[model samples]
Target: MQNSILLTGATGFVGGAILNRLHHEKKHSVVAVIRGDSHLQMQNVPTVRIGTFDSDTQWKENLVGSDVIIHSAARVHVMNDTEANPLAAFRKVNVEGTLNLARQAAASGVRRFIFISSIKVNGEGTTLGTAYNADDAPAPVDPYGISKMEAEQGLRKLAEETTMEVVIIRPVLVYGPGVKANFLSMMRWLNKGIPLPFGAIYNSRSLVALDNLVDLVLTCINHPAAANQTFLVSDGEDLSTTELLSKMANALHKPARLIPVPCWVLQGGAALLGKNGLSQRLCGSLRVDITKTRNLLGWTPPVSVDEALAATALHFQEHQ
Candidate 1:
């Protein structure tokens, strides 16, 4: 049956990819909800402009006739937020805004709600060999993660009280074309043949490609088994920092000029440079075990890491 789908964040990086995927499939009618008129123009997809997520904005009209709602719009993590209360700022959008949308969607007869969360809901990093799984207790250490955890709780409660099915997905670092922030910085540095000091770092991390994440989101849209379940998704292959940089260099067709620096030295230097968090991210282990995601959904990441990296590099080269 052709389903009427409501997709939020249709203009952002990951959301745009999801929108393209759905458009190409041509199996569902999509209504994109954007904050303003600045949205992608598609041939048949209609758009609704909702200014903000406060109480005054009415989402019911948009929710009507929508069988599924993919809630991807959120106030993402601000690395250097100057707000007096960062947690409150995040909760205003990520928590309250999300619940508001879910409530309206439930009331409007939406059958399913898919929420994209972060693996930071688990913690910052993991031990050397251990990987984070779905069963791990949530240990959010930052404002953004706390808000996501709160949103997940609120959605689960709503599901218990209503008929709408909620599926929560916690994905690790997602990378692909159009990716910005630290990932983009790293790619640019690699493209310029900058010698990085992560050659000796031996920490493993799991990451999901944009295409893989979109595939998983589509799976949860109507899959009966995905109802009321929390999933941890990744590329199913883990890599160390050194290995990752090397692979990225290969994809960029450049030499991986890396200098071997002691882990302690790297951490100390980062602290002195006011980038301690960056150091942890570069030299820490954070792996996610996707055994549950695989066994339950019978799904696998369609793109390999090498292929995804190559695509990303090619896009960067062309855009630059």
Candidate 2:
């Protein structure tokens, strides 16, 4: 469909990728809302500057003539949050802020609102043989997850009260292009031939390529089936920690050197070192079933995991 769309978080990995695709496709009139001081200058894609995204952020003039608003902006999880009340800090931007934006967009005549929520809304990790789906009740653990769950609840209530259609997408770890944090660190360590203890990690996890997620977002722009539905997304393939490392090694053209350390031993060591969370992320299972996403929208991830990993490795090499 050819319609005007307003996008938030244009400076982020996910939002930036979406903006680049929209600019390349030229299928819709696009408006990117970003931080006021951000020096992001893109050709063709117009931008609106909102200094800070919170409950008070303005959007009437910006949302004008926009039929769709892709709300990809959020306050991501912090490893070391210094706030006295971390939940309140997260609520300011993630819950209250998100609802504020949605309320304004609905009032401004926006037809559809696509919210980029996190898989954490389901929980941190799943049992080895189990995966999360939209039917599962939200089991948010930390402040970040709790905040996202609240925002999603608010959005659904808003949708019931307004004319706007809401599409919620909860994706597993998103990787590719300008990836950072744990994914980048993993690649860097692998490239330097760092022998990892994940050789024996038999746990499974899922990831989504940036291209795949952006493609799904674009599809939701007009697909009636996606409206007012929550989707759990992944790469359609689950890999153990060892398998993921091996794939990364292959993509980076490096030999994998892994130690067959016992999972219990690693967990015990991590507990002693106060890194249990880190160990769990490496050794536990967290997967999502996207069968509904595929069946409802007839959409498939265009980029294969191996191809996405190769492209990510290439980008890392060039940047380094």
Candidate 3:
């Protein structure tokens, strides 16, 4: 069902991808909330420029009569040791900012609030051979994850108190064109012909392509099965680090220079460099069960990992 949707984080990576999909499909009239200087990117869309997050985005009025509220803005960082209060900084945007927008949406009588949360809320993706599902208890380990978990609770509570239906989506490691962080790092490494030592590793990890995630988000916006439910999503396929890198190299038409370094030795070396945590994160298992999303909404990821990787490789080849 086409509806008026208030899309936050329209300038961000995943959110931008969602916006592009929505526009091309012409499924929703989007009211994009963006920063003042970032208005250039929202040229053809109805937009509102806001400078702060404290109950003053002026986008609230736009939320009136909207069908869905896709809240995608958040404070995301792998590591944060800045002198500033970390929890407060994240809470301000992730929790408080979210509440502010949610409150407005509720007050505006929006139908559903679709929150794009991270899998970190479930905790570090270790504990190999185990997959996290929607019903599993939340065990967030980092400040960011904690804040997101808190926000989830707040949204649930708000839903009980208001008319808005909340659809919480926990996506694990999303990748596509315009990817960043570890995905970009891997791309650069492969592009430079660097031999990575991940060939010997065989830990399974789950990832979601941007298009797959966008499709699920669209489903959450209107599907009856998604109303007031939490879901975990992935590409519906698991790939080990070696398989991932090899596929990436193949997509880039570069030789897969993967060395056969033993996992224990790599872990020990990382431990000596005070990067044992990095070792755990990079080589750990993070499989997620996406059965609920598929069975409930009758949705499926539209692209294979190979196709997604090829698209990303082409994107980098054109832009970088």
Sort by lDDT, best first: what order?
2, 1, 3
Q: For residues 1-320, could you state the per-residue lDDT of candidate 2 as single tens digits? A: 79899999998899999999999898998989888687455766688988888999888888879899999998888888999999998999999999999999999989999999999999999998889998699999999999999999999999999999999999899999779999999999999999888789899999999999999999999999998999988789899999999999999999999899999999999999999998999999999999899999999998899999999999999999
By descending TM-score, how would the candidates be arranged? 2, 1, 3
Ranking 2 against 3 by TM-score, winner: 2
10 residues in a row with least lDDT, candidate 2:
36-45
Taken over the whole model, the C-alpha lDDT of each candidate is 0.91, 0.92, 0.86
**Which residue pairs of candidate 3 clash?**
none
Better of 1 and 3 by TM-score: 1
Which residue pairs in model 2 clash with each other?
Answer: none
Model 3 per-residue lDDT at 160: 98
Q: Rate residue 59 of model 1 by lDDT.
A: 89
Write down the worst ten-residue block by lDDT for model 3.
53-62
Candidate 3: list runs displaced more than 4 Å.
40-42, 55-59
**What are the per-residue Cα lDDT tens digits for candidate 3 across 70-110?**
98878885553683688777888888888888888888888
Q: How accurate is candidate 3 locally (lDDT)?
A: 0.86
RMSD of each: 1.1, 0.9, 1.5
Clashes of each: 0, 0, 0
